[model samples]
Target: MTLHDDAVRVLKDWTAPDAPDGAQEQLRLDYLDHLVSHRDGLWRSCLPAHLTASAVVVDPVQGRVLLTLHPKVGRWLQMGGHCEPEDGTLAAAALREATEESGIPGLRLLGDGGGGPIPVRLDRHRVRCTGRGRPENVHLDVQYVALAPAGAEASISEESLDLRWFGYGALPELTDRSVRELVALARRTTG
Candidate 1:
């Protein structure tokens, strides 16, 4: 099956208690339906809505999370981005992004043992279309929790201005609510 097909199946089977309400769940279902209905829905350039994967990386021993300073958005956020065609699954995409952006290897998805990559959160947020000259679009983000190996060191990539670990209670002021929510969910899931 194609990556898009896998995404459809994964989202269909996945459930989250932090989905906020019925509307959020409906939005996820709608995203799945959109993926099924459109041939190019999985691609990043798929106009208004497309699938994105991200991770809230944490060092359980340190009680801290690794966040990147996104240059484009000017916010400290989790490591994630658009799904690449080479990604075999949404979980793989999330892991790939986390590893690539955080410069930390051996990070494991928290709930990804044998059942597949279970999302820790589902967030749909609007992103301004500045680079491509397109209008504002929605990123249907599938979020996962990745545990960083103890004593792991992180380096910033070209995509981010800075990368650092922040204590859960001392997150940066620029961090967004969605990111905070993802971190909380990750802590709960791991605990």
Candidate 2:
């Protein structure tokens, strides 16, 4: 199927009962509509491709953010995974992933500007892999910000060697540029 059609299919999964409510839903629908309307045929050819959703959980109090040292890429990255049909919304998918990867239950999802305990509507970006000999591996990531309580416990999943919080100012030492940008963006927007 075409990319737009695929996006629509994914959107249906996102809006199910388990999904986030109101403005977050609207943002997700709007984003899907934009994706559906703008394929222009090229993305259609990239069929069978995978789409992923991720969450960046930030502890504003410590000026620190959570990251995973992914086993596959061996780089520090945000928490996320492939968008499965069961995941109702992009944010839901992100939350599910963050919960699973970080082993942090009851994570509060914050979007861009909601006054709820957790804000809603966060920045989304695409990841283009650039290793020495490998071509780019593209991941369309729908990023959401959430909060993990201070000194909240975290553990490394088999998929990652390390799962830890780092001071935003020290993100430069992290292995991935995309994650660094994500950290920077989270600091700006969260601030």
Candidate 1 per-residue C-alpha lDDT over 9-118 given as tens digits, one digit per residue, 9 for 90 to 100: 88888774644457657767888888877778867788888888999889988889999999989999999999898999988999999999999999998776688668
For each candidate in turn, the TM-score is 0.93, 0.65
lDDT of the structure predicted as candidate 1? 0.86
Question: Model 2: residues >4 Å from true position, as ranges?
Answer: 1-48, 112-137
**Please, what are the lDDT tens digits per residue for candidate 2 over residues 71-188?**
7666788898766556655556778889899988778777435422222223334334343555454454556677787677787777778888888887636456667766776788
Instruction: Tell me the alpha-carbon RMSD of every candidate.
Output: 1.6, 8.2
Give candidate 1 regions above 4 Å deviation: 18-20, 129-133
Worst 10 residues of 1 by lDDT: 15-24
Number of the top-ranking candidate, with TM-score as the measure: 1
Q: What local lDDT does model 2 show for residue 171?
A: 66
**lDDT of each prediction vs. the true structure?**
0.86, 0.63
Tell me model 2's lDDT, rounded to 2 decimals. 0.63
